[model samples]
Target: MPIHGNKMKKVFCYSLIFGILQLIPIRALGWGFKAHRQLNYAAVFTLPPELFKFYKPHINYITEKAVNADKRRYAFADEACRHFLDADHYEKKVPIDTIPNAWNNAVLKYSEDTLLAYGIVPWHLQRVQYQLTKAFAEKNLYLILKLSADLGHYAADLHVPLHSTENYNGQLTEQEGIHSLWESRLYELFEPNYDFFTGRASYLPNVSETIWERFAQSFAALDSVLIFEKLAGLKHPNKYSLQSNGRTNVKVYNEAFCIYYNHLLNGMIERRARASINLIGSLWYTAWVDAGQPDLSNLKEEPLKTENNDETLIQTLFQNSRIIGRKED
Candidate 1:
């Protein structure tokens, strides 16, 4: 059963194109890649003097690696789940008290498959916090920097309203692809005016509760995110136009429509970005404090050799299972 060379070549070419397309940042979810990196970079400045010296020197690494988790989604089976929690998918729905904040307890209530089937962001975030704490305890420069960038990413994702809903991209509500539009397109257009000077990072007394509360707030705001977009569309019909987004010219909501939408939502993107900055810094501070506030002045930098390493891993991860939960993309 040997395949012909041409057929094999065609398959390989098609597969390569598909993988490249996935990484092209056309329209996925969760703040897009650029915004995540910017948030991580800014969060470094928010760290106190105690951890600033160590993190500031490696700010570029932290910033670039901030999207590591997003890239990992293609490779790691559970990586996508870590980015979001569609709490509404569970029977109890949002503000769900039935599922424990703890991993084992939650697994007991709803089997491991079930928990993974509906998203496990809060638990995954807690796990990452613990990892960061461990890294701080050991003073492992590599692990500390790696986990800090990673933890910041997950914390930021939790603040995204679309990430917390089953209808993440608004496909279910007939507002399909609204996830990228709200979180990505808006920020790409209006982030220059955002207030990123969100003060110093404070200690979070209860990390799990804080994360859960953030998700709850995000889910609560999901309705407005959708409704306002619908309203804006009605008010400004035929406002979309083809615009050059990188190498492609795609249809996008025009500047006027986007401004109208942003006004209608009372600056949701700015608020969420600010919230992400604060939360990322606070969580990093919390992990460091919980680990005895280790002095990292002497920590050395360990930059990743290949930025495209995750892409290779993603190609493999995608080959295994592209569908994690309710939505395929």
Candidate 2:
């Protein structure tokens, strides 16, 4: 929880000018906080008994903290960019296949600022996998649990169709706010009836390829996400509309319209949610296996990490700052 000199400076500045950046009322709507928590909670059941035993004791922590990455967006200037990747943003000049899987290579080609400007979710997911592997090998309970929760969140983000597109919220296409409508509103409304029993975790032979493939699939689905919403709007018109609040002000959406839209999408939201649940477990198990299958039995009896006041300060600033919507999704 310790912030380095520069990050500390950023945090200090955030405290001074809290809620100064309110250009848009929208927040970066990931898979929604509840789905994230549920996905992480379900992922624990997928772990092998040996690993599951350690995680089972801390399942609540994992589930609750799954949105820490999203929360961090309020505290860190660079944090927002890590939650999404506008893959089609680069497709105009850069072929999707040509983007490097490695961080250093991507930086060399596109420059660090440019990549961060777009997103580094896939590359960052790759980086966290290594960190989780190292943490597991060393039996660092706190680090392992922390990385596991974060990895689950990032993997879920990658599966979101909006997170993979330049027109994430349909802002460019006059479908503004569609990002939250698809990712947050629909799922939150209807997810109770959806299934969560996605089977056991398995080891991934190549994490990079799998991560890239997920974003590729998400990118391909972007059109359907937009097209269906527009068609549903035409068919349903004002029937499903309702009003709500944004981070700073009022907002609106149609529940019945969303339900009908969800129906037209043919279970896409459920499929993505299910895939996230399955992939999260697989990634966690894969990291553990690659780390030589460390014994977690002893660590379960021990406390993971001690309290840190720096984290408390950062959290205070996060609450004070009303910043939202740095990246589209």
Across 1-329, the per-residue lDDT of candidate 1 in tens digits comes to 77689778757754674456444433234787779999999898888887787788789889988877875665555666777777777733456676688799889888998877778888889999999999999998888878998998988888898877778877777887687778777889889989998899999999989988888888888889989989999999876899885788988778888889999999888888988998999999999999998888776655654435654765675564343334434
Superposition error at 31 for model 1 (Å) = 0.7
* Per-residue lDDT of 319 in model 1: 69
Give one digit per residue, the lDDT tens place, for model 2 in 1-329. 89999779867765453334333344454787778999899888887787788889789889977977876675667678888887876784223677888788889989998898888789888889999999999998889888998999999998898887777778889888788788878888889988998888889999999888887878778888999999998988874444544434344576678778998999999999888888999999999999999878777545545235336645655575644436443
TM-score for predicted model 1 compared with the true structure? 0.86
User: How far off is residue 296 in model 1, in Å?
Assistant: 1.6
Clashes of each: 0, 1
The TM-scores, one per candidate, come to 0.86, 0.85
Q: Lowest summed lDDT over 10 consecutive residues: which window, candidate 1?
A: 320-329
